[model samples]
Target chain A: MKKQWYDYLWILSLTYLILGFFNIMFAWLGLICFFVPLLISLIKGTKGYCNRYCGRGQLFGLLGGTFGLSRKKDIPKWMKSKWFRYGFLIFFFAMFFLMLWNTYLVFAGARDLKEVVTLLWTFKVPWHWAYHGTLIHPGAAQFAFGFYSVMLTSTVLGLITMVLFKPRSWCVYCPMGTMTQIICKIKDKK
Target chain B: MSSIRKKRKAFVEQADCVACGCCVKVCPLGAIRIISGIMAQVDMEKCVGCGKCAKECPASVIAVKEVTA
Candidate 1:
């Protein structure tokens, strides 16, 4: 295969530039796109976006593929222990609940976009560096809070997953991946 | 035609593969193919160690290594 510097750049640019911008504005839609590729990867057994598409993945893939830095050998048995997997599941659901509660707050008019943003920034959390929107406004704070909650939940889950499950565990248990796996199983059975 | 024997470098562990097709889809040289009865294979001659296949294989079954030219 022809490995070009441009391919790596394109993946980074699309992920950080296009996806990052859309995620800040159309949060739900952005989540869908972000998670869908992960789900597709899990069910299909491919890194999907991470291998060729994700900005983060591109960075890592380039380092590993070019410099031989991040290439994995064997996933240690302790890392893949049942306790870790189950613990991840618990954390995943808990985060999901938190996300739901945050969403409820938004719909119930208990919060707004600005409030969410401030809460996130106050917590020293940065969702996407480029499009932070307004920092001090109430609506922006609310938006940040809601946005950051999702980001935190996913980030924590992703970190644990990678450390424990071969650097792609989030792709397997992702709600999007869960849904797709279910669908794929059903299709296989049929 | 230059006659030089190319070293074999394609390593696939079927037992570990989840058959995600990321290798097949991302292979810039179209070297990897998934046979739907449920296994995947790599065409050694076509593979150039771009590492796209190995990078995308979620199961980590595909590994690319450098061999003598």
Candidate 2:
């Protein structure tokens, strides 16, 4: 198969993810980077992001593909079941909204930044150990949290899918992918 | 190309299936699998109705059908 153009997007994301952990200002990019694809998916559908330029998916492949650490095996039947897919989608949406709400509260001064930073839902995975590799100053904590949250969410889902199935497998059941499909269905109808 | 497009997912005719793994290998989502090392099976949830398997199948047994509610 021919190499796709977007296959290289991982380089940019990988750079930001690794270097941003140190310069928290660069980490702030994660806060807004999601919208670029969300807008495109509204027009071109999930394929715009999932099939083409998903950085997280590329990272998963880099870490777990043939040359990487993971061994390939057939995914279990239960994991492929409809119940698990939809349930994960629902849970994902709920957490997404909750994160936004918490962020809003911090910005509006209704809640402390510390509270938002340490929210129970902001779960981090082992990949974050790389960021701790940097000597993060206290002043950059806000940006660090944004960087951490974005990586945490994507890495959590990516790792789960990679461990259970193939790295790209999660794209099939992603909430954003599902939402993009719904948008395309509506557009096709009109 | 069929100009009359239908939102179709892959459907396998059991009798015509030779258990050849072409479709399984070609499927982007890994949605098609050989069950018990015998027949080909499609996972509807994983399938985006992409028709990649149909185009790749050697047996000419798999076709995409309109799955309207």
Q: Find the candidate with the highest TM-score and give its number.
A: 2
lDDT, residue B34, candidate 2: 58
lDDT of 1 by residue, B15-47 (tens): 444444546757777788754313468887787
Task: Give the alpha carbon lDDT tens digit for every residue of A18-115 in model 1.
Answer: 45334455443345445656565456644344334444334333444445443344455443344554465566566556656665676567865332
Q: What is candidate 2's CA lDDT for residue A98?
A: 64
- Estimate the TM-score for candidate 2: 0.59
- The deviation in Å at residue B19 for candidate 2 is 24
- Model 2 ranges with Cα > 4 A deviation: A31-33, A115-147, B1-69
Q: Per-prediction interface RMSD?
A: 6.1, 12.5
User: Residue A59 deviation, candidate 1, in Å?
Assistant: 3.8
Error of 1 at A79 (Å): 5.2
Off by over 4 Å in 1: A2-29, A32-56, A67-71, A78-94, A111-144, A148-179, B1-31, B34-59, B62-69
lDDT of 2 at B59: 37
lDDT, candidate 1, at A140:
42
